[model samples]
Target: MTDPGMKCTRCRQPARFRLPAHNAHFCDPCLDLFFKRQVQKAIKDYAMLRPGQEVLVAVSGGKDSLALWLTLEELGYRTAGVHLCLEMGEFSEASLQSCRQMAARLGRPLHEASLGQLTDGLSMQEIVWATRRQFCSVCGTFKRHFLNRLCLELGFDTVATGHHLDDEAGRLLGNLIHNHLDYLQAMWPVLESGGDAATGFARKVKPLCRLEGAEIRAFAQVHELPVAQGKCAGSKGATLLYYQKAMDQLEADMPGTKHNFYLEFLRQKAAPPPPPQLGGRCQICGAPTMSELCGVCRMLAQARQWREKRRARLAAEEAAAPTP
Candidate 1:
């Protein structure tokens, strides 16, 4: 017994459906084949996963992360869920709870760390306020650094993130706008030699980079995976949104616009500049860096400087304003 017609996830056309493993309803013939091929292609094209290797999945309780963890498990890779609680009030609690429930439902093990534990008594808000950097950079840096370090400490050979095709395209285009060839080349599916003091041999992989965020949303809907539909509580500003909207407009004008961008870039014989030559690991922490202090610390100091200048400017403006 099957529905004769179902909405296609990709093209959004009414079409027949077939059940994908893990209880997902995918459109028959075209979309089904497309999805399967996408998954296989990503795996083969990037060498995302290796046989019998353990993967630490950075789960955010979102469609993409959940889909990735489930897919890896279904594909027989040993997956350990890694979640970070940013301690952003209620939002953080809800995210952590949702992740825990999903892990329980799937009978998968999950590892978690809190921002409070990692930073020196610094909340994400404080970090942003002090560093004068935008919200995304502060949070992103802490999360990525913590995740990699945790993976190394835990002895996992590879770290998997839930960056989808749309995200990848966005980064590529952003880099292209600024001509950041080194960063662009780092967009490969697999990132080997993800250096960290704890796990000197940690590599990072992105298996879902070929799948669109929309596809992951569709998969979540088909499987009824629990997820948050709202934006992150800690999210603010407009740089990322502006870029995403611009790219979205391109996709609207031309179907598969994002995919084509990546495909075309891959066809180019472009490799990033050789890895940076490091003098020595930071005496405080053993992570890759050039100066005595790493980028994270430098960024944090810059954020603080920005905040001080902003405060002074505001105070000067207030003092100069005529009395009402």
Candidate 2:
């Protein structure tokens, strides 16, 4: 027996309010449909997909990725879901299972890559603890690296990611805060070929970029796509999580904050500037960068320096403390 109100997906309680678009009997289903449509439209308007091209989808077995996979298949794009099993603990097993179940249900080919194979003895936990960086970055880098490599190796022409509007907006805001204008420019509908590992040789696009997170959540609920609930173990204290939380809080207080900010971002018009010149490859990675060293290598170098400084501080503190 169901209550009169729409039901929540995470919790089986009746939804607080009616979502009109999906004609949701429950809030979750309504949100799911809304997100799917938004993703479908974004793909079409941005020309993100080609009819015959095989899309190498990076599935985390979560709502966002699952929604993307199903929607792309529904829209007639031939897709194969590829999952990277980071093996972060019990969560890794669950994530892998979710990925397999979803792929089997959707009847699409699913490929899996393991971090253990790629890391050359560096586990995800080792990288996070050693680098003093969140596992999200390492996991993201490895995932993107593996995804693109898999695509190129398998002859896939493009890669599709489930980065929605909220993710994009939060990223843009994060860039603004950090003054990383180059990355801001790189976040376009069709990214120009460059240093990005994901697009080194194959094109990559985000069909779900225009949709909101809530909408994606709703779409998944309506379609009843099998998605696992829980945060990535490596994501517990990630910087992106903090930024996302801040953005979510702001959006909650000021509804549509992310949506409106991005709409205005799209509508932005600026005075014409000089024509752009071409770029050369970085000496280290052969990837295009404004400087001789690519941004990624440059950042890693800075991180190493920061790590050294932090170690020295910790050592000094330990020396200064009286023996117990």
Candidate 3:
């Protein structure tokens, strides 16, 4: 049937891929079916997106997001793509090109925004340096802000992201280790639109939560999806990488480990006593916030201060350089 190899678990055709967690091998078609089924299961189980609710997919030009956009389109959902350009030099250019290529391939409209416009002419790296905040923290807040803004402007009520099983499993490990109950409560397959109308909050869902990162990469490869290659330069050595590596090692030792860890966590539905957090509009951007100032506002304020200092220092250095 397929390429003359081991029989596919479903159809006895030659298997092209093996899923140790499922204890099965599948041909190309079966693997495709499996991906769709898992996605469908997650969406239905969580009531993630309604039949006709417009979905604005957050595509980062990564394999996960590429797979998500393609899968949702294949599943017959009305969808569009939103990409945030962090202006990280070549990486940013490659990412935007990938998004455009995918959108062209799928014939879907792609919306683009830049870090400079989003953060008062500051890039993500600049924001991190200026605010002395973690890179991921700064990037996440800005991305959230942009996604919320796009969702409102485009009239998309549901915003879907590309978070998958491996990501969740690793995050679960960290949260469990740190005993961060508030973050635990917040990490759901579906996060409803928050804040009032002015907040530009849209319902966020993770349709790919059931698929593994490997599965997504493989799927993207098989389908020839145009996804940006290479990791962001900013995330060179993140703690989350260690957590993910630990989970990967555990999963290698025991199949289904990652899947079970994340799924069971969701199934248990344990809620800890909610942590005390501030709740008010960001005085600057007017987004919903746990604190008086939202993350973007805080970063913007610091970024401006840092920029001024940087300019002054550069001017001093240039002036002091004798005989250029």
Among these predictions, the greatest TM-score belongs to 3
lDDT of 3 by residue, 1-324 (tens): 124467889998888777888888887788899999999999988888877567899999989998999999999998899998999988889999999999999999999988787677877888888888778877877888888877877777788999999888999999999999878888888877755545646788899999888887768767989888778987867778889999999989998999899999888985322222437778887777778887678778888999999999999999999984
- Models ranked on TM-score: 3, 1, 2
Error of 2 at 268 (Å): 1.8
lDDT of 1 by residue, 1-324 (tens): 136666665666665553332233455445435555676688777666777568889998888888788777777788889999888777778778878878987798999999877765567887777766788977888887778788888888788988888787888878889898678766676667634446343677788877777777766665677785566855767366666677788876766787778767865735423333546665456677667876666665665676678789999999999999
TM-score of each: 0.81, 0.74, 0.93
Each model's lDDT comes to 0.72, 0.70, 0.84
* Candidate scoring better on TM-score of 2 and 3: 3
Give candidate 2's error at residue 226 in angstroms.
Answer: 1.8
RMSD (Å) of each candidate, 1 decimal: 6.0, 6.6, 2.7
Q: Give me candidate 1's TM-score against the actual structure.
A: 0.81
How close to the true structure is residue 47 of candidate 2, measured as C-alpha lDDT? Answer: 68
Instruction: Specify the poorest-scoring 10-residue window by lDDT in model 3.
Output: 270-279
Candidate 2 residue lDDT tens string, 1-324: 134655765455566434332334445544545555777677666667767667888898888899889888887888998888887777778888888999999899999888777554446666666566667786677576567667766767687888887788888788889999777665565543333444354567888887777777667666787887677766677677667788888877776688677656755722212222337666765554468875445545555566677789999999999999
